[model samples]
Target: MRRVIKNDDSEVKKSNLGYIEGNSNNNLKISKILYKEQKGFCIYTEEYLGRADARDIEHFDPTLKGTSDDSYSNWFLVKHQWNKEKSSKWADYQPVLHPTASDFNERIVYDDGDYRVSELDDQEAINLIKLLKLDDIILADERKKYIQRKAKELSIYGVSPEDFFKILIDDDIKQISYLRAIHEEFKIDIWNLLPNPQ
Candidate 1:
């Protein structure tokens, strides 16, 4: 199992990513979604629209007191750029089975007619790998064969079938623990539509 230090700043440099400040406590939830989906990236645009918009300045006033609109705009741009890089890497490695939609827009529309900014980072790559369950799914029959073939085509290192399965099971346990932490810290209903812990 990979021992990821929760406070590791080195990973920050490696991933070169930043997240929305208010959403830091929700990293586990975000990680879970990234891991389980084939696309390897997730967006909460609709969910965060009203809440992050500048028009609802009052909404963010509590958390972002004294923060400028420019700061928020810069964060949004960073977020979009990071996610795109992450998604592109996944596309280059795996089958195109999991396709992600483009969520970047020139202007964001919110109820208040104000724009919502985004944050970005490269740090989630490891978390995303564990979340996408690719380590496990790749061991399954069809997926395993497909991944092996693709790895060979790309001249990439491949995992043993035995190791792949083991990693999957291990990642599942780690993912659950991570999710629990996020739910507890953020007080969000993250498990509502997600699968029950196995």
Candidate 2:
């Protein structure tokens, strides 16, 4: 007896929804079409720009509004506004500068080494909290201890006793060297504590 074979063209066609291409532009075009179909609006600036051009919309430069200087400046303004609004909502949100500690100076000097331990105030305490939060090297307990020790050492410098407890919990630091490298080379405090190295 001969068996009849069922065709699976529909399933195959569904599986191959779109043709793959080695070129990035072809992929981008397919992505844009799919995105537009799903979301009505293209989130990608390239796709949006292309759409705008096709529609003959002038003064709709996606680059200018997406990533150029004008866009960046506008974004900065928006960010500043958001920050101000957030700070207003939270009274404790004080702005502190994160200057890279000098290599020649002590790795853990507070208040730029001018007032020593004698002149620390609420602001200084806040600053230390910011530094601790920014630095991934220190843990919660260690940060508290460091703040207390620094406060005591700088008590003569007018450090505040009450504000030293405003600790900010941080994510675990991944690599210890990551913090050191950033501080040493880039002069930036972008430490994120990771789980203990395996």
Q: TM-score winner among the candidates?
A: 2
lDDT of 2 by residue, 1-198 (tens): 001121234332334433233555544443443333222211111111223333211111223332333311111111122223233333243443222222212323333211122234645334433432423233333434444454464465453322221121122121122222223332333222222121
lDDT of each: 0.29, 0.28
lDDT, residue 198, candidate 1: 17
Query: What stretches of model 1 exceed 4 Å from their correct place?
Result: 1-19, 39-198
lDDT of 1 by residue, 99-166 (tens): 12133221111111222222223223323333333233322233334334533633443565334334
| Candidate that would win on lDDT | 1
TM-score of decoy 1 = 0.17
Candidate 2 differs from the real structure by a C-alpha RMSD in angstroms, to one decimal, of: 22.3
What are the candidates' C-alpha RMSDs?
18.6, 22.3
